[model samples]
Target: MLETLGRSLDSAIRKIRRLPQIDKDAINALIQDLQRALLSSDVKVELVFKMTENIKKEAMNTTLQKAKRKDFIIKLVHDELIKTLGGKKAPIRIKPGKKNIILLVGIQGSGKTTTIGKLSQFYKSKGYKVAAVTTDTYRPGAYEQLVQLTKQIGVKCYGNPKEKNAIKIGVQETKKAMNDGNELIIVDTAGRHKEEKELMKEMAVLEQKLKPNEVCLVIDGSIGQQAYNQAEVFAKTTSLGSIIVTKLDGTAKGGGALSACVAANIGIRFIGIGEKIDEFEEFEPTTFIGTILGIPDLEGLVQRVQEAEVMPDPETVKRMMRGKFTLEDLYQQLKSIKKVGKFKQILAMMGGGNIPDALKDDAEKNIEKWRVVLDSMTAEEKESPNLIKKSRKRRIAIGSGTDYAVINKMLDQFRQMKKMMKRFTQMRQKGKGGMPGMPGMGKGAEQFMKKMSKDFKF
Candidate 1:
């Protein structure tokens, strides 16, 4: 996301880190570079200038010496970026033991239907009994589309494809969801464009009749400067609790859409990173800016991992600790990584520094190839990778229709991975009263998340 802007900002920060001294000229040059990057990414000229002005004033006023000055400047820029993107708004959360209704509104092609599906899966994965109610009676197949999307993730959806009255469907479906024991109900409305008066009227009607716990505006990330107008128009019709920006994946206008939406006086609650249902995530401005500046967002990474349920289970952890790691386990690990996100995306969250594009692509391809090769192997061979000797490798390669070298590389990687896991196991065992066992993790995990959200250093 915002790859161009991120690369530009990362380069400037790395340059500062490498520089022996950051004089006045260096600071001015950095500001100029920031302006250029923001402009190139389609950020509103006014917001960019204001952010730079704040950064300049703070950096110039800092009394720190050379070493500390650089740190101060980086932090100043990070904080300013966050402030511009709506700093630290209260997170949108479901009230326990209460029925939560979220109404989503947006213009045509804004990805409202898909986002509702994603939100359903997102909340469902977190243990919420989620259901989606489709009030989009105008759009052809809108209800069916939502049903198909939500069905893949096992989210219940209620809609009347034949119903012309959207408010009726919304009211009835929502009541049905509440009666069905659903904790979270996400309502999808008809997409309204600038010239569509009737649909816009329908939106206000649905909002009034449904009385959603929260009304959310879904804006396309590539809408750029127009996002401001769209957000404002939607706000006038219905009070927005938050905004959800879609199609941010690799979009240059993502920056513009974000700043423009926030400028409309509404905080962004979530961002769509890609087309996948699981790619949508909560928007944290501090972590976002820190990521752009190459800061490691461990909390964000952990959240994704948790959402994906990628953590090793107790049985698997015990097996690894007992040196029972095998190709099957490695295959499962690769699958978990895929579920979490793309390799490059994961790298970004972990502060991946200057990795060559070729390597990133190759790594992604290798994972796909690894999965294929592992699939070709028998259950016995996967359990005992040692059983697959030279002859077995060639046979498996032919069976998978992949190069023999791929299998060789995979085996070598597995060996190195196993060794690393062994070392970590030893280190853990050696510690007196070491890291908490996986079994006792959930008791305080919620409290831990709360504390981290407040005190987490982005």
Candidate 2:
């Protein structure tokens, strides 16, 4: 959803690369690009103006010499962008050893009940005894759905579907959950519009009855410009202390929902990236912003890629055991990682464990380029990479919009991995080796060390 925004921002950097100097004209042009991208993504116009003005003012105030000005100016723009998105993450507190009730309230269709399940799982994974209780009597089968979700996550669910009195259900179920020794009790309230007086009042009453530790307003990410109004009304109606934005899977309005958190002076406690229970994430601003700026969160990136469960097949495993790793296996692994996300969705959230700092950026940015390069290779070239002589490299480079040097680098990386595998086999034979469980760490790391060593000649 933020692809357009990232690409637009990248365009500004590319423009800097093309400019002879970071002069006043260049700063104005960059600000215009920034403003256009933010506004087009439905950012509040006033915020855009404010952000661009700040960027321009800072750019003009920089004392860097002409030779070093571009990098500083670009970094200034990136920093300002991060600041626009709250500058930092403040996670919602759900302490252990206490019956911490979290009341989730949101307008209809905000995915509130589902988020309750996700939130429960999140805390459960952190060793908290989690339970889910739903008082969503407004939406038919809402309680049933919540029950199923809780069942899937192995958490106990409370609240009767036929119970129309939300406050009664909330009070009873919340107490029951506490008595049952649940440390984190996520109470799912019925979704209601701010204008729905009866439902709003019921939510307020339920909040008072349950006395939740946190009253989180779950806003649908696609609510766009209306997030502020919804948040404001709910804040007025109840003790709205936290926000969770949901359905951020593909909606362009995601940016608006996120920015609205800042516009309304609220910090987003969590964000739902997909319908899956594990898709929910704590809103960490630095990692989020780093991903946007094409900086790979190596640990996060690796974990996510590994979560895709891409592994070598038996045949490939045998080859790997024999120290015969090949490009074919690497290509399949990379394709699976790509299935997790686009090669470069910088603003989309960003990566892997223990990747060298030097290679993380190159790795994050080159997946797409490598895909093109690999796709341009012939079947024979893939099966026998060493066969790609200078003439073949020249041909492939032209076809892939890359250069011969990059192809050589890739070849070197492949051989390096192969050699590392051979070394592992030799070490095991000599009873002198044990691989670390973590990818890209310890002695085995040499296999992945230079996988994306430096910028490719793309």
Candidate 3:
């Protein structure tokens, strides 16, 4: 998400990792590089200086030998980042078995309404009876937009286009949601401009009247330095209980928004990675820093996999364990990958060191091509790939609009996969355990592969 800043920070880390010895000069150079990166990303100058100062003091005072310097520096930077982006974890507060009210507020076009949709879907998927209520009567299409989002996520939405009173609508909808047995009530208020006092007044009324359990300030992550000011205003006007930074994906200034929120003392509760309704995720600062520094976020990856429900069915798992893998199963695997995320994004979560960006891009394209080729093949050909002769290959190539060589390569890949599966099955059957040396892995090898496929999906 913060690709520019991530690259800059990673560059400095790589330099330190390559150094045989880290001295005063090396530490100073790293700090300077970090300063440039954070500044360029619009992180507040004061916070940047403070973080660097802390890192420098700690590094200079450390008596660790040169051999441990690299690890120490990484840990220092990671800890400093976590401290800057909320010292202690502030998890989303949702009271179970009670009507939890979440009031979302932000400036116009800050993704407040869309974030409500994401939050509704998030809570709903967690087994809560969630309902969305739109009090944005001033915005022409705000109510309709929320209605459409709630319908898509299979949640109930309450709004009145004819009513001009936002607080009145909010009060009515919340009461209705409570009476209807909804466990979560998400209220979407009208987006206000900083200069618009009338809209702010309406929001204040709802804050007092509703006494929401959570007053979330939604800030657009691309706003850069302005994010700080926006967050401050919201925090003051509504006593912002938490913050949700939206549109972080593909934003070069995401670093600014996150740092800004932290500087304003607003704990980030969630981050909207994309425009999709399901793109909203809980924010974890340590994991986020690790992600930026090229470390694999195993926890976040697992969460996404679970959200996508990409686990292999028992029947499919049984078939693979029996060494009956086929092109159809491979097609299903590809579909699961698509369900998770883009290949490059998956690679980033798996630690960027494992795959170059160029290869990731090519692999993404190849995956789509593979799906098309599989689609072009007949059901019988997919089940019995051995039956596809030269004629069938040419026909499939023409149907899929791919070169014959691509099809041949896919077949070769399938052959390698089948061979691997067969060997793994044989190893388990012979009771030799995983890889002939790795102990305690009779069938664990296959299970590990399945877990990897589920988590990485690439």
lDDT (tens digit, per residue) of candidate 3 on 1-458: 78898999988888987898888999999999999988988888998999999999988876443545567776788778878788544656778889789999987898988998899888888888999999987778988999988889899998888888888899988999899998889999888644578877888899999988889999999998788898877776777888899988868888889988888887888999999988878898877888887757545534543433333465666676688989877655545554453322222222321233443344455877888899999888998899989999999999999998878867876675577557756865775535643233445555555554454452
lDDT of 3 at 368: 79
Question: How many pairs of residues collide in model 2?
Answer: 10
Local distance difference test, each candidate: 0.76, 0.72, 0.77
The candidate that achieves the highest lDDT relative to the unseen native structure? 3
- After superposition, the stretches of candidate 2 with alpha carbons farther than 4 Å from their true spots are 18-20, 193-195, 297-458
The TM-score that candidate 2 achieves is: 0.63
lDDT (C-alpha) at residue 201 in model 3: 82
In model 3, the runs with Cα more than 4 Å from the true position are: 193-195, 297-458
TM-score of each: 0.63, 0.63, 0.63
RMSD of each: 20.1, 19.8, 18.7
Tens digits of lDDT, candidate 2, 15-89: 986899878888888889888878877788888898889888878986544655766666666667768778554
Q: Ten consecutive residues with minimal summed lDDT in candidate 2?
A: 343-352
User: Between 2 and 3, whose lDDT is larger?
Assistant: 3
Q: Taking the tens digit of each residue's C-alpha lDDT, what string does model 1 give over 48-106?
A: 99999888887777644354667667776777788779865576668856888999999
Instruction: Return the lDDT, model 1, position 28.
Output: 88
Residue pairs in candidate 2 whose N, alpha carbon or C atoms collide under 3 angstroms: 291-346, 292-346, 298-351, 298-352, 299-352, 300-351, 301-351, 301-352, 302-351, 302-352
* Residue 187 of model 3, lDDT score: 94
RMSD score of candidate 3 (Å) = 18.7
